[model samples]
Target: MTHPSTDTATSALPPLIKGPHERRLGVVALVATLGGLLFGYDTGVINGALLPMTQELGLTSITEGVVTSSLLFGAALGAVTIGRLSDAWGRRRTILLLAVLFFVGTINCVSAPSFEVLVIGRVLLGLAVGGASAVVPVFLAELAPYEIRGSLSGRNEVMIVSGQLAAFVVNAIIGNVLGHVDGVWRIMLAVAALPAIALFFGMLRMPESPRWLLSKGRNEDAVRVLSTIRSPERAEAEARDIRATVALEERTTTAGLGEVLRNKWLVRIVVIGIGVAVFQQLTGINSILYYGQVVLAESGFGAQAALIANIAPGIIGVVGAFVALWMMERVNRRTTFITGYALTAICHFLIGFASVSVPTDSAARPYILLILIVAFVGSMQTFLNVATWVLLSEIFPLRIRALGMGISVFCLWVTNALLSLYFPTIIGTFGITGSFFGFAAVNALALVAMIRFLPETRGRTLEAVEEGVTTGAIFTIRSRSRHR
Candidate 1:
């Protein structure tokens, strides 16, 4: 029942305690991540479901690519547009809207009697996924105390991987139990609606992001929300910081996207954000997520085995994310990015090398390739995926945070869409070896990009990061709140 007295509230706050406040924050993060769960299940379900879908719809390779890539293209658009909408409409409201979209999209997908309707449904779901990608991490970052922001924002990422794991398991069970059964894919697709429903109802009870409230000049509301997840002294101090940052930021008020582009520092950060997004996608992770079954079958596994084998990466991905949550609190952001790229690039090359070196009928290529792919996914979840989203959430100023994330993820999905669109063809022409070799080359370039362009945002408050980036002090590799 202790309250932060007026005197201490104006002074520095004490360190955080691990108790009710942390539990409440954890609850909020979990609820918000229901959106992320939908994101993963909707995206990853297609990997196992596509074959059955193709059988029923009589899809050609070209149409299969279209059906798969259409959602990614829609995600690109959704990332940009719905993200912008969140800035205007508020984070909670936008997420609620996305939830409804997820449910409707799932229903559309489940009931689609033809390929065209299914693609339309996939596009609709993509909007929800893309919007969540843009907004959920931001919401978590804003709600969390700066000291633990990395791990808290990272929860959404864990949920994303968990959802993918759920999808893989569900598909394995359904596809195996009802092998080639009519509309088996629809059962897999329909599982997504449950989380969408949870997200809609769960978000209803969550508070608006305090930072967003502060941006709207609702300081009292901001502090109230913060207090629920932080100590009163911490909440008040945090609210004060947010309010000052909001007041100081120009682009958020009078300036628009055009104005932000004109500012070189903002533009630099935005460009870097976009490049990071592209890098994460180009690691060829989604190639495995969306088309793993195809890759495995070609590598020599039977359809049933590939379906089961795909679950391995899903399991490792979730495990890696849990590891990442721990690392996010302890490691430097730039270090993880560099290490992730180096490790993933090496794994990519090994997969390519092993794919070609081993005989096609050796009966070992599938297992070898599977191990390498799982390692690549592990390296990614442990280093890149969580760090990528955390950096995007924290790198930009509050004024342009939404824009930076939206545009960056837009580019990410665009790259993903292109890769998805052409990957079947890539596999057709060049096979697994060539496609992965190409991924290796891309990761090499991405590693260089990370070393040079990525900055350390760990131990920095959002306001501190903004000041460092805008004032060009970021080059000094220091922050205003490093001690915190």
Candidate 2:
């Protein structure tokens, strides 16, 4: 059976009995996205906390690196492991498990008295962060209607950045006001627990992914869940389409690691997924997020000024994400990716030039570099970051969606882990000029790869995209002239 077009399905379905369903969906999306918020705060809090933490714990530079990267290491494992677990157990259950882990991990970080114990805590938090990153967007996508999936799934990224911004603001306040207090860093670490608690409580009322239920041969339950989020007519139509796609796949061998490797088209798409995941990090975005204060200080700002300056990028990041949400509905994903890279690569070049051309002692040098950095962050948020996560959530076939996403994001977290571990050394060895110049080169290559390989998924249903993937028609599908 052929998949029905979303428009035709919606048209044939009854007029949406709007009120309670939309509100419920909105609430579910909000509660589910709390995972994104915790993911942000836990990862970003360390930026400012690490300095005071070092003094309190008597940490060496090596130990500090270990503490910072340990979370990333844990996240890589979480992305893959939790992804597979979500596939087996279900998305809602996996996320609920992550919520409990977030609470426990935050408590560990807040109470730890030694560096070794703190690293252990960070590893736990990392696992939660990684799991959320891998699962939350897909959860939202699976629950959302095809027409609104981009915006709904993309909201998780906005929440992620918002969480990061909240961490920056909180760290700034605590760092400046409580700089003299004993263990001020503990306060920063402890604040994350609030969201963890919120996530756990919020998820209790949320629904499981309907697509997942359908996958498990529970069609009635899938329709029931879908009805809560969709109009009655739309719900039944979507259920029919999903069942058709699942039945088609069941006629063939199951998709797995072996199947992905043996099928040339599947391998091609998986490689594309990995490439986007890697290039997203290679843009040098996280290095800035994880170490913005350090980068600013190196640009010649005083310690206090550098801490305050870090908040600028965070502000612009949120603003840019709003722009991205607006654009995701109108623009093609491939176009957005290419535009983001071009803008960021140019910003990277200007940052390098400003660092070298302006004398270190000049009053304007740091401010100039700060503006360029903010521009880069804004460009990245507007195009690359949100679009990348949304595409990852939508691109894979239903059979291996979770596993494929886990593997792709696993590579992303690994790249992020390596950079978080060695970013300081890169700066120490090459200085700002060399480091940003390298980012420029990497982004240039990224732009080319996006143009050649990235398929546009702006207005298609997840099932429709899966059909294209299975038939190898995605690569040949031209960009839609007008977004629906």
| Alpha-carbon runs more than 4 Å astray in model 2 | 2-17, 479-484
The prediction achieving the highest lDDT against the true structure is 2
Per-candidate TM-scores read: 0.95, 0.97
Q: lDDT tens digits, residues 1-484, model 2?
A: 6655534544544554677889899999999999999988888999999999999999999999999999999999999999888988999989999999999999998999898899899999999999998999999999987767898999999999999999999999999899999999999889988888888888887889999999999998999999898878778878887888888878863757998888888888888899999999999999989999999999999999898899999999999998999988888888899899999999999999999999999999999999899999999999999999999999998988888899999999999999989999999999999999999999999999998888877777888888778778877765442243
Model 2 residue 480 lDDT? Answer: 48
Model 2: how large is the Cα RMSD against the reference? 1.6
| Model 1 misplaced stretches (Cα beyond 4 Å) | 1-13, 250-255, 478-484
Can you write out model 1's per-residue Cα lDDT over 90-178, one digit (the tens) per residue?
99999999999999999999999999999999999988889999999888888877678899999999999999999999999998898
| Residue pairs in clash, model 1 | none
Candidate 2 lowest-lDDT run of ten = 5-14
